[model samples]
Target: MNAFGMNAFGMTALPTRRQLLSFAAAALAAGVLPRRAGARPLDDVVAAGRLMVAVYRDNPPFSHRKGGALVGVDVDLARAIAGRLGVGVEFMELTAGEAVSDDLRNAVWRGPVVGGGVADVMMHVPYQKEFGLRNPEAVLFGPYQREGFALARNPMRMTQPMLASLPDEPVGVEIDSIPDFYLLGAFGGRLRERLVHYMTIPEAVEALVKGDVAAVVATQSQVEAALGDRAAGFPITPVTFPGMMASSWDIGMAVKENSRDLAYAVGDAVTALLEDGTLPEIFRKHGVTHNAIPVE
Candidate 1:
């Protein structure tokens, strides 16, 4: 029998060691195996019996801590992928770096000088061709969700649909977020005086729900999660500005460029999760609607 203890269809299986040795000899003779020694990230993960995943901390509905445990859509997804790989998972919560490139460098390939080191995979990476070109060391793939900004406003405060109505009252947004920057300069800087910045989108949305701000601009998922049942009273609408080139973009996972095998494996897992509707289910469990990206 073969090493797996299975015989071929209608034939006896070859002996284990002998057949393996013969195949190795043939492979060596044919130069099928490279002479250079290198360690694959996948191999390391399998050998260590654990997969390390990098996820952003304080981002709700994606990755965040809840009830004294790290829990979110991305957290569940990472655990699912690790289960598929038959390995344990270690989630490394990290604050987002200044830019995606810095995150890729610090989390995917080269770990920070002080931290525990790079993770095997990082979720919520922007799946843009231009971004991929800029960061060659990281391979961004498996576009799972398409995310975009939306404006959620308290109906009791402002009933106007136009963006010009916000000057009388302040509008809230996450500090340094795309919506914050967009509103800061929108309408020839007219809204600048009425812009209020919060540390996170949830905080901005909270202010809107409490009637502290007339409106809040943030991602659709973030707005929905923050508003919860109060969302029924508020209106969440897609937002478009003069300088906004794209309202939506796809988010994916990233791995070191050298870890193509792991990337492909993770991609397959993501595809399977999407096909079976597990990914969307995870998002729904977090009280957020999942906007899936069309697979190309």
Candidate 2:
């Protein structure tokens, strides 16, 4: 018996399309709806609507272009995150070294970059003390995986004595990477004294295949992917670092300092997945063997 046939509860009006969509998304997350109603949290995300996932597309097996689609471990993870949020995924190709470059500094996702807002979150970021110190705003997610490098060699050439005597062999490594740091510093500059150095890990792999060098030290992921694919005939194997040379590292999604709310949410999401064994299951499907890195 009130105005517009509404009661005296001060009824405002019908729900907007955006509100309807938002409610639906929350319902979907809560499992109240089974159809995955829509891919939009509120509205179709036609405007102000995209979760940009920044990643390095070149270094394969992590983030890369495969089958004309943006794919890899990081890619799948990003899609899953967006799907949970009821949002569409947008691939933002990026790398770590160029983090402070003009492109990144001016990148824009939500608001204006002048305010130092985030354009996208970087995925598969290695936990580095220097990076954390420099970008106090940066936050890493759970240790999605524990990984290390090893010298893969042909089984025919493998021997316990040869493995033990590797310090004297010419080794290949990339410039300015963990391997380079380990070999140059941890190895007592032994690579220079014994193993030959390569401009890249692949170069070293080539050297190993061609017998140019005895072995090359590289990440397990890189070694596995390369050898599994085009390098199938190489007959490579792995040798984990001896003892606790370096504590295992946890790599995760990297969010800007300003977007702490988003960071915390994402971090929590990752941690929850780890706790429930979801993340590990995905890694298993990808054939990525790793240790679960707990998120504090």
Candidate 3:
């Protein structure tokens, strides 16, 4: 969701606040951690009375802090899963790594060098075949939400709400995001000078509100949250960049590879939450639409 994690939408993401973690090599080394190491089994987790959930810091509508309290979709999902397991929830807020692979190593299987030990389970991980295969040390599963991109435009500025018009109109995008790359590279770089960069999608959407840009391209949830009551003035629709990598994906959780039992238990809990409509409620509470459940 960049609503879920930074760099979740792109294969080659731009450098973020958490640059390529300097400890990646050591954390990802084959023998750095004993198999299963600190990852608690399902039984142990219940015994300890809490599930350590790792979520991205400052990821609004997903896991951001509000008035010094953590409240968002992913936070609520973690609490729901822990509630189902009869345990309390403990959060391990994460800074976005250069890529999701690095996040898996530092938060799911191996602890980062700076030393907040690995969490028992991490939320908002990309659930994809190639990505899962590449990070075999972590078992990625239980995709609860489907994420996609959208365009939020000021109707007063752009009479035409089509992707084709972006080349000629000013558009706002989060710096180093899928939207930024696509807008910069698409149409033979014609949109490069027309692009305005923001540190976050909400900022870009805000710029759209202020008429600083004709349109803002970002994850649907981010645009929705930013637009709030103002959404009526703007058209928000599912959008795609023709040749951009991963314009949409399913977001799930990750655990140590040795913790398959934990994965199964969490999966069952997630399925129950989705079936009973609790997940969608969480999204609605955050003012973000639950687009659709991830395809199995």
Candidate 4:
């Protein structure tokens, strides 16, 4: 992914409103094809015979590149959903934006001017009420998996699995992530000075494995994937702090607010996948444990 969070697709320079209007005028004069009037996102996708899915790039065990091919649980899930929809799948790799709302705008509803516009659907959206309320332009549904923060500690440096032990030694976390904020204010801010921020969770885990930090805090699946073979040595355990809203949260998919049909179809596909144990099977292929989110 690039600095702007664009993946291999490369970010296109966004054109100004005047430039867009001029271009549209030129295209119209040239008799360029326009979208069918009043077509919904799902209708456009189905008519084009392709389902474009936005997923985070460089996020392992969920969505990432391997052997020059995109492979991860989210990748598989997207493909499965596309298959269920009887359309070809296109995975748009993206780096996470400042917030899920930004991601929804850039990837789900309003496409980045650079990436040929927004995708039909985006995966790994937080299935929370407050977020949905805040982002009325997007629809969040189809909770597929439950994820929680976890600590992976180097046993030689940290004897206990608790978050309180991190003050004496540095702890690693992805910069600007939930764990980063949590640790910064944890224990009355005692661990603030000792918090080591990295660009990503895998980087933090690597620092922990190298003994540069006493522990690393990230998602459970991320810790597991980063530990890999060394998982036997570094113990991963769920961590909690006072005033935490919830230990775990459900991850789902998001579509444009107008694409309720698309959301429903994707939700049905997810249900079928879960019922046949395909989602868990995808997690197993990535060597991470899956915690199924009960359908509500």
Per TM-score, the best of the predicted structures is 3
lDDT, candidate 2, equals 0.54
Whole-model lDDT, model 3? 0.81
Q: Model 2, 1-296: lDDT tens per residue?
A: 11111111111124446645743553355343233111122232325457766776565677777777776777777777666656677876753332332222223222222232334566765554543553344555444776655657654454442335564556666555555555665544455565566665657676777877666667766665555554555544455444433534556556655565666656676777766777766665555655665436
Lowest-sum lDDT 10-residue window in model 1? 1-10
Per-residue lDDT over 65-150 for candidate 4, one digit per residue giving the tens place of the 0 to 100 score: 89999999899999988998889998888777534555776687655534356677888877777668856778999988888778
Model 1 TM: 0.82
Ranking by TM-score: 3, 1, 4, 2
Q: Runs in model 1 with CA error above 4 Å?
A: 1-40, 160-167
Give the per-residue lDDT of model 1 (tens digit) for 1-296.
Answer: 01211110011123457655753554454344333322247777788888889998877878988888999889999998898888999988878653555566667776653545678899888777766875678898988878777788877787865566664798998886667767888878888998998997778887887778999887888888888878888888866655545677778889988999999888898889888989899888887888888746
At residue 204, candidate 4 shows an lDDT of 88
Model 3 per-residue lDDT tens digits across residues 138-161: 999998878889988877777776
Q: Point out where model 4 deviates above 4 Å.
A: 1-44, 113-115
Best by lDDT: 3
What would the TM-scores of all predictions be? 0.82, 0.63, 0.89, 0.80
What ranges in model 3 sit over 4 Å off?
A: 1-6, 10-24, 27-37, 294-296
Residue 279, model 3: lDDT of 84
Q: Whole-model lDDT, candidate 1?
A: 0.75
Residue-pair clashes per prediction, in order, are 0, 6, 0, 3
How far residue 239's Cα lies from its native spot in candidate 1, in Å, is 1.2
